[model samples]
Target: MKNSNIKNIIFDLGDVILNIDVPVASLSFAKLSGREQAEILTLFKENDLFRQFETGLLDEASFRNLIRKLVDSPDWTDEMIDTAWNSLLLDMPVERVELLKTLRSKYRLFLLSNTSSIHITQVNKILEAATGIKNLDELFDKVYLSYEMGIMKPDPEIYLQVLKEQNIKAEETLFLDDNSDNIKSAAKLGIDTILVQKPVTILEYLKDYAV
Candidate 1:
């Protein structure tokens, strides 16, 4: 594949730009609530709470309250819940940051992620601590977060909304995501897409464009 018509690049956050381990967070929550990790993971999927939180349908306090109830731990403080919730967010590699910097010179870069406020805050802190970059805004031309937009990936409306709001053409945009469903949705709308999978980071996938 060549990049002859790719004017705008939209990148995913988790498992694409930022490293995340969902099982790690599940384990942390399990330990906190004295439940099995498998059970904790199952609970996370039972009520669509994760999706609700990512799409801004559920506020932080309400999400936390629901989590406490789900875990059967009524006494867990806000800080404790937040820590467990943020455990999945690992780090943003410096090389990936450098690649974004290099690519910014050629393409209008954008970030599109399904995320929550708590995770975004922690990710900014991690980015600042690691590379002295205050936030993701420093790396991309613009950012589109699901919680802020009240929409999420795999939904055609979100992709269409980004295109409409940015005044960018779908044919000229290339979307890279870790999730196949998101990639498929973007592709259906005439946007080019790459499914970034494990072991092959964006740096490897988009190495040609970094130049």
Candidate 2:
């Protein structure tokens, strides 16, 4: 397909622009819960707990309870869980913020992330300190977080919602996300997408995609 139809841009937060370290998060949680990483991760996936949290099926407190239940440990406190989960939002890439800003001036830029309160709180605080940006509110034309939207990426509905809210056609939106599944899901709806690999920033990707 041609780039002629592209008008809006939607971005995924973690790992794409925010630089999530999955290893760090897993190791941190493993240490906190005093369990083997494999064991905890097994339960996390098996229970669909991660999906539930990202997709907004569970709130912060409930997610903590779910983790505590998995560990069967009374030591799993709120601070401990928050610390572990927030490890993923390690830092924001400076070049990415610049790229987003440049794109915002051109396209109707939006952020659609599958994130929860614990990480979102830390990300906002860090961005304020790092870039002096007000917060999520000042960042994009609209910010659609899964915890608030009741939908997450890899689901077509979430992308549809973005298009619907912006009153833009799927053909007119280009989605930038780190996950291949998410890219494919958006592509299924005829939306342009770029699957980001490490060490390549958004600026480089957009140079090829943006007309």
The regions of model 1 sitting more than 4 angstroms off are: none
RMSD of 2: 2.0
lDDT of each: 0.92, 0.83
Candidate 2 similarity to native, TM-score: 0.92
Look at candidate 1 and give me any clashing residue pairs. Answer: none
- List the candidates' TM-scores in order: 0.96, 0.92
Candidate 2 lDDT trough over 10 residues, lowest sum: 202-211
The residue-by-residue lDDT of candidate 2 on 66-176, one tens digit each, is 988888876777988888888867788677787777777778888989888778889988888778885876879999999888877888998888888789988888888
Per-residue lDDT over 1-211 for candidate 1, one digit per residue giving the tens place of the 0 to 100 score: 6568999999999988889997888899999989999998888899888899999999999999999989889999999999999999998899999898998999999999999999999999999988999989989989999999998889999999989988999999999999999999999999999999999889888988876
